[model samples]
Target: MTAARAAALPGSEAPAGDERLGEILRALDEDFLAVLGWDWERRVITWPRQHPVIGLPDCPVPGCPLAITVSTRPMCGGCMERWRGSSLPLEEFLLVPKQTSRGTGQGPCVVAGCGRPRVTVAGRLCLAHHVQHTSAGLRVLSLEEFLAHPGVVGHAEFGPCEVAACYLKAVSGQVPYCEAHLNRLYRARTAPGFDEAHWRRTDKAICTTREVSLRGMPERLVAELLYGLWVRTREGFKSRPECLRPVYDRLRARQVQQLEEVTDPAAHGHGREQVTMIRAGSERCAC
Candidate 1:
């Protein structure tokens, strides 16, 4: 090795002009990078809500932005209910102007020991807790006093939802599905070719996260990704999956089979800096 290259080696001090990243990457074996990268890849497999590949489709109404809680619904729950109540025909009713504000989904109840899904935003309590709070004996209880001594707790989770892709907990121990999937099951019961067994495997997950999938990515691209992922971690740079997601998407979009094929590594959005670092490492590699 040349004097500058030798100086940048692991045991030696890196010279001022030498970018030590090259030497650092050179020291990491292919096997090491591959194993670490795959581990990180698996950890990031939980796809984010509204992810282009795995996310649930939104309500189909002309202006509705809310996601369809039930996959079988033609419109949002609110719009569906409104249409059912109106005497107007489907086409005419759709034409009528209606305010469309996307809904913020409910969360677990506020009571200290309660984990039931809250009934409404205002109540911030599950149906069971709401009933108890409204009863004559409990009417005078202060919010603080009730929170401190909330009687009888419900389970935080029954189990992971039955759908293979779904990560949300089931609605309750007795319920076979989460609330969203339960609604979907009822609506689709009579639909032609609807089968619970197949549905369990095919249903999309319905939760928010920052994860992504590396499935179907070409081999060479995965090689580059793994190598780059290792290099970034070694360099004290952030290796967030959300940040790397765009890099993976763009490379896959271009059908990049090899790292050398990436002519403009700076163009990958969000993770441009990370890709650039990867490109620099690729250049240093003889392979």
Candidate 2:
């Protein structure tokens, strides 16, 4: 059965009359007894033959027949259409008397006393006000014009970040930068003749430690030694190796010590014996 018809069946939470009416119509041909509460006398007397005898129980509008389906208002379609065209608020349209207005399809913008029609954003402000407060590019700056500039800026009200495709609002109340970018700007300001490339490389070397390995140690560690191993200067260590070389050398030495502990006779006899046996076999089969 269709949803409208099913909902009209007995015990549904929706208005019972419409759903009940739909249910009677659906069951009329298949089960006459079910439609008439299994009363055979009522079934024969009230069943539709040439035409349906069932009519709406009550209608609020005087002398108006409720012929429209359950989905629409409980009045005739003609009355409902006239009500829609009237100036009444949409929520209370079905309950109130018809109102008088210019009969234009559109309504006024949401801003108070702004008589302009809401053509740009329905039920919101007009295009001019939207552009003035939120985005200059919305009206003044075209796509080609904005593309000329590397980073797009917004009007004071918009307050979006400078990075393309990032909609995060700028953290500083008036400045162009967000909290993260603002910190970088401050860092640059404090540094004397800061080299952007050098700083970027140093920052990456000092901060990154995920899924990274040193030459001797296979598993990744929490320390930044992994970055020092890969990012190297002409002297075979990262520039300013004094800052990181000590940590890298210590970790490498610790790894070697751990390996030695595993093979030492006092710890595991099998490890030392295996190495000794392998060396002896290599000597016997010298090619």
Candidate 3:
């Protein structure tokens, strides 16, 4: 019989021809959409031509009876709940823009421990809280500002000449002690007679002197003076038996070199006299 006659016959299987049924079945198996509603004789799967409300033509979510396509997926509420209970399906979820209310456009603040609207980076917390907590906690004050405060000058929290001196030096941005003193402390700490009590005494003295002098000086000047003194004292002490003579000599040489670098003749002239005075003083003092 002819291939067309066999295909048209009711309840009769089509005769094997050049286009084998097995080949057609294999092609249908390869296509997912073709399996939906495929007809062997017709050689076509019926698919909805128009775009469905949901991207998927048919959703396999369980317990969904409605045929209407959903905005995201056609799954009914029941199917969505079931899917969510197991694992989240990518197809079932949709991204939507965040909504805003009309009253006040300001959204909730993201910063922790803050109820106020976030404005600046530092102002994550409310202005009042930020000022009260951070500003007060740090005791933020410039050198001049701190020195000008009566409490800082004579506060019980900062006492003793040595401690006061160190604090002042730190505040004024000066070296706290003569270089000799710094060397002495460094040597003492590393020496055989090193003791906590001795350290405390020495430290106290240095701080007290620095604090007193720093009260009226600029931070930079105070720091430089204290540092110079500390270096001289420290090195002098470290050099033991050599005494201040050698230390003074070294310092003088350094000072002279520095003076030479100054283009101004007057400034250069002043250091020579100071160097002489320092050397004279060192000669009289015992290490």
In angstroms, the error of model 3 at 237 is: 26
Model 3 lDDT tens row, 68-143: 2333544543445555775655454422211221111122223343334322222222333334334663358653
Question: What tens digits encode model 2's per-residue C-alpha lDDT throughout 1-287?
Answer: 34553444345323445433343333233232233222211111111112122222223444433333222355545566776677866556556643332221233444444444333222244433444435744446554553343443332332543422122335444554434444665677578886644332222111111111122332122111211122221113212222233333333434432222234344234333433432332232212
- Candidate 1, residues 1-287: lDDT per residue as tens digits? 23543343345323345343344344445554333333322322432235223244455666654544444666656778988999988878767755644333346778876667766434567767777878887768776666666463554655656764444446666766767777777887778988887666555444232344343344345545555655555555545444566666566555566666777735845566767888776555545
Candidate lDDT values, in order = 0.55, 0.34, 0.31
Which 10-residue window in model 1 sums to the lowest lDDT? Answer: 40-49
Q: What is the lDDT of residue 242 in candidate 2?
A: 27
Over 4 Å off, model 2: 1-63, 70-74, 90-92, 96-287
Residue 267's lDDT in candidate 1: 80
How does residue 42 of candidate 3 score in lDDT? 27
Q: What is candidate 2's TM-score against the reference?
A: 0.15
What's the CA RMSD for each of the models? 14.6, 34.0, 41.6
Give me the overall lDDT of model 3. Answer: 0.31
